[model samples]
Target: MKLSLGEIADRFDLSLKGDPAIEISNLASIDQAVHGDLVFLFNSSHRKHLTDTKASAVVMREIDCTDCQIPYLISERPRLTWANVAKLFDPLPMQAATRHPSAIVSDQAIIGAGVSMGPHSVISAGAVIGDGSTIGAGSFVGEGSKIGEHCRVFPNVTLYHMVCLGDRVTIHSGAVIGADGFGFEPNKGAFVKIPQIRGVVIGDDVEIGAGTTIDRGALCDTVVEDGVKIDNQVQIGHATRIGGDTIISGCTAIAGSTRIGRNCWIGGAVGIIDNIEITDQVEVTAMSLVTQSITVRGRYSSGTGLMRGRDWKRNIAAFKRLSNLFKRVRKLESERGD
Candidate 1:
């Protein structure tokens, strides 16, 4: 899949600084790039390595091209241009339209045209699978589930009963949607299990990563709005409503009944407490412990930065005595009367 620099520049709308006839076939990092490989310089930290790269073509900002000797593609956003160019050589594999004999599709299920059902895939009674959807091996779509057009349910994925997914939704391998949420009632020292009766509703163009578990609601439907991107191993609790276009990173645990607003970016390993309301456009930094509701739309961080172990212990001790120290300082200030 080699393409000349001229073709790449024309396709990506970038300006070519060197020989446009030079051909590049693959993409690599600046440090490991070889002949016929395409490399890119995006961060200023990698500027020093550009001069020594052996790549046939380099995608870089116009300002960083002074010492670069290779055939270069100049762009305002080099990283974006490099990504678009890389897609030309690395295209997604197209799945063939076929239903394996081992697949168990119920007679009551309505399957659309061009759908591919792999081995051991099960579509339960009253399930509707839309056109061009591919259900991978061992995937199960429970009864009354509605999967929209062009959805891809990867291997071992499970959609429980009554789960509704809109068009172009992609659930990666080992994802479990519509699972029972953690709901219990305290009855005088014994915990009583509360029956989970609601379903999960996922909107269009949502891509859920591998091993992510989205719990079903206790009484109301758990909703994930359009264009929401959830990373791997995330735990989305029951009755939660995630607004449109929100991006949640890996290992994030969102508690039940929480309402997360639109376009919010939740970083990795963030723990959001139950029943909390986070407004739109909020950014939660990685490893943050969100213990309270965030009504304002702003970036919030709670995790402490890395430090020497001894220094961290000292800082923690100091932080604990801050109230007493503040009182002493106030008394000293009163005596000085300055």
Candidate 2:
């Protein structure tokens, strides 16, 4: 996809400082771009490359436009403008409706127009696939499940019984939604399984990454509200209700019955204990362990930061002296008796 610098500037409403006739054929980094390619310099640290870059045009802020001979599209938000320009090149694929002969679709299933069911995919009895939705190769749509219009369920995804996906939802490969929740009781020295009776309800425009697992609820549905972005290899436990626009990063494990409020940011590798209620706009840093409910909106973190091995050992030793120090301080205060 080729776009002229003038066209891009006019469309994005950015001020142009270079020749308007220059054609941009591709996008590249400031260091990697050659002539006819578009590049970006959003960080001040990379400003050194401004004069040396071979890019035909650069997307940059007005301040960085100094001492540069090349043409540039000045944007207050260069990164955001660069994203818009990139979309002009790499647009989403619009595939025609296709259903392979190898697909196994039940007669009772309802499939709308412009649907694509790939080879060996299964549409169970009473399943409803909305228009313009694509079920990838070998994916399984469970009985009575509903997939909304324009939803994309990639290969090997398993949507268990009665799961509901809203419009524009994207589920990546190997994601298992509506799986059984980890619920059991210790009865007579044996663990008895509690029934996972409810399904998963995902809202519109939500994107679930690969290898993620969202468990089915015990009684009520496990609800993921609209515009939530979930990263790869994440496991969300059953009965968890995630509010709108929350971002969950990779390798995070949220325990069962947790209620996460809107716009929260959960970092990678974080471990949250079950039955917790985290309020809106809370941000948890990477690798932290959350043990209780977070009621206030703020950045929360646990786990020690990285340090030298000797320093870490010394810090651990110092913690052991805290109890003794408290006792001595208490005795001294009692003797003073003010």
lDDT of 2 at 121: 99
* Candidate lDDT values, in order: 0.94, 0.94
Error of 1 at 34 (Å): 2.1
Candidate number with greatest TM-score: 2
Best by lDDT: 2
Candidate 1 residue lDDT tens string, 1-338: 88888988898888898888898889999999999998988887888887888889888887888867777888889878866777787666657889999999999999999999999999999999999999999999999999999999999999999899999999999999999999999999999999999999999999999999999999999999999999999999999999999999999999999999999999999999999999999999999999998999999999799999999999999999999999999999999995
lDDT at residue 151 of model 2 (Cα atoms): 96
TM-score of predicted structure 1: 0.92
Root-mean-square deviation of candidate 2: 1.8
Q: After superposition, how far is residue 323 of candidate 1 from its true place, in Å?
A: 5.9
Clashes of each: 0, 0
Write candidate 2's Cα lDDT for 81-145 as tens digits.
87888888885676579999999999999999999999999999999999999999999999999
Question: Per-residue lDDT for 108 in model 1?
Answer: 100
